[model samples]
Target: MTASHNWPPIDPADGWALILTELQRDLERIDPDLVMGQVKQKFGTLSVSAEASDPALADAVHGRIAAAEALSARICERCGQPGRIRQRPDGWYQALCNRHALEAASEMEGES
Candidate 1:
């Protein structure tokens, strides 16, 4: 199969964007005719939908998705930098760089 040009639009500011791009390239290598159906981000996780002619190609795409998801957990949402996932007292979760994480903590403390 040949890779189709139906890749979903992505926000460049998102740290995980690069990972998605790499996945697209890898998918092209695996099957150039593969159809990328949809891509979306929700609750700090990325979802990619793809269709391939063969089971092996589909599995490869799934593997790529898993790797990208793992990488997103360590990338800051606010800035494209190394980070850790943090949860607010209100139960909201975000991945942020150290600087942003500290700032968020300070803000939460001030709310008290």
Candidate 2:
């Protein structure tokens, strides 16, 4: 696994929690009444503002997801060897090596 040398001041393990805290704070400060109205109207929330958007936030989310993927890639769920993220037929997030991905497909089928 490639060590992310460009990681922020926080430890890698703590990055996700810290970023999520900031994300929640940012969202909460954005006027919850408007946010709720938008959600009811559009069935989805708006994207973060450019001004409020932190490069660190993007990097943090990517790094956490990627780390999960990288871990799945390294250890096969079924065969127990180096694995990689493969697309599941059911179209959901399932971290598995090539072989276990298929296994996960059945397990994850019909799951939202």
Q: lDDT: which candidate is best?
A: 1
- List model 2 lDDT by residue over 1-112, tens digit each: 1112212233334313333334334443442221211101011111222221344455544444334434443444444455544555644343346666665776676464
Per-candidate TM-score against the hidden true structure: 0.72, 0.26
Single out the weakest 10-residue window by summed lDDT for candidate 1.
1-10
lDDT of 1 by residue, 1-112 (tens): 3554677666787677777778888888877878777776556656677888677778887787778777877888777689878786767777778898888888999999
| Angstrom error at residue 79, model 1 | 1.9
**TM-score, model 1 to reference:** 0.72
Query: Backbone clashes per model, in order?
Result: 5, 1
* Runs with alpha carbons beyond 4 Å of true place in candidate 1: 1-4, 102-112
For candidate 1, the per-residue lDDT at 62 reads: 77
lDDT of 2 at 48: 27
